[model samples]
Target: MCFLFLFSLPIDTSDRQKSLPYGTDPEYFKMPTRQHLQASSSSKVNTSAKYHEKDDISSDIDNELSVIFRTLQDLRNLKENSTVSPRTEQKSASEKLLKITELQAAIGDLKRRNAKQRIVKMPQKQN
Candidate 1:
């Protein structure tokens, strides 16, 4: 009974298949080997490197776009200020000119009234 049980133990056939050339059998396709693992790992490294470059480029583009937007906003503000500034300055200048003209007219009127009020004294006989 002992010998029968020993002979009936399951045999490991994996060592026998290792001796065959790679890809010679269809069943080995499902199993992964060291070379396959290394190849996949190397490909992953290359893909990660490319991804890092893509991320850097995207970040640079985002920064540039933000800068462009800020510049455009500043330009718009400058345009608005430029358009409004001249009108306000012209209005203020006209107001000051009007005030000066009014003052001049009032002064001339006062001078004319004073000139008309001057009294002439009669010449007295010399004794």
Candidate 2:
């Protein structure tokens, strides 16, 4: 049994070297240095900055949407209020309609901007 075990062991060092994926080079598994760590951290910071920017844009959209809702509510109130003269109500309604259209255009512009930013940030898949 001892003789069989001895014969089974690899007699050539070249065979061991050949088995290593990186050819036994110590550099292949070297620990990351400070520069590499800093670089990675900087990338993380930039990623976070992008997230903050996106959050800001989202908040702006929310604000615009809230303003639009308020405008619509005002229009409804104007319709219900019998005290207001027809001419004044019509003028207010037209003004509110114009404001709504402007808000819609602004929201559309924001959406397009957000979409563009997303496309720019997306990583390209390598073939």
Candidate 3:
């Protein structure tokens, strides 16, 4: 069991030099050191200036939104002012209804006159 465990452990490659087919050293495959890893992880990036620039744009966006909302309100007011009053609409609707009823009565009179026509059959000559 101990021999199997020892064989399963990874072999150290400190003394061995890995050569490439082009005879160039592998610079990209070097393992990172503790100091290099810590230096990369501890670096602080300052973004306050970028955030302030975005804040200025946010204020401009808010101003534009307010202008759009005000324009919408003005359009609503204009539409309400240009529309006809309820009393005028009611009068026009009643006039249309009266015209429709008169047309329906005229149609009924024509239908009755059409029904009164007799279908006369002519006598055929003997062949």
The lDDT for every candidate, in the order shown, is: 0.63, 0.78, 0.58
**How high is the lDDT of residue 68 in model 2?**
71
> Candidates 1 and 3: which is better by lDDT?
1
Per-residue lDDT of model 2, residues 1-127, tens digit only: 9999999997888876556675567566678999999999999999999986875554465677687778777767754467989998888778988977887887787787778778878999999
lDDT of 3 by residue, 1-127 (tens): 9989999999878546554547666866688999988776665323666654544432343454465566546544542334889997777668656755765665564454444332223456699
lDDT of 1 by residue, 1-127 (tens): 9989999999989987667776587665577889989999999999999975754432333454465566546544542235567879787568656755765665565554444443223456699
- Candidate 2 at residue 117, lDDT? 70
Candidate 2 vs candidate 3: the TM-score winner is 2
Pairs that clash in candidate 3: none
Estimate TM-scores for all models: 0.29, 0.42, 0.29
The model with the greatest lDDT is 2
Question: lDDT at 12 for candidate 2?
Answer: 84
List the pairs of residues colliding in candidate 2.
Answer: none
Tell me the lDDT of candidate 1. 0.63
Weakest 10 consecutive residues of candidate 2 by summed lDDT: 55-64
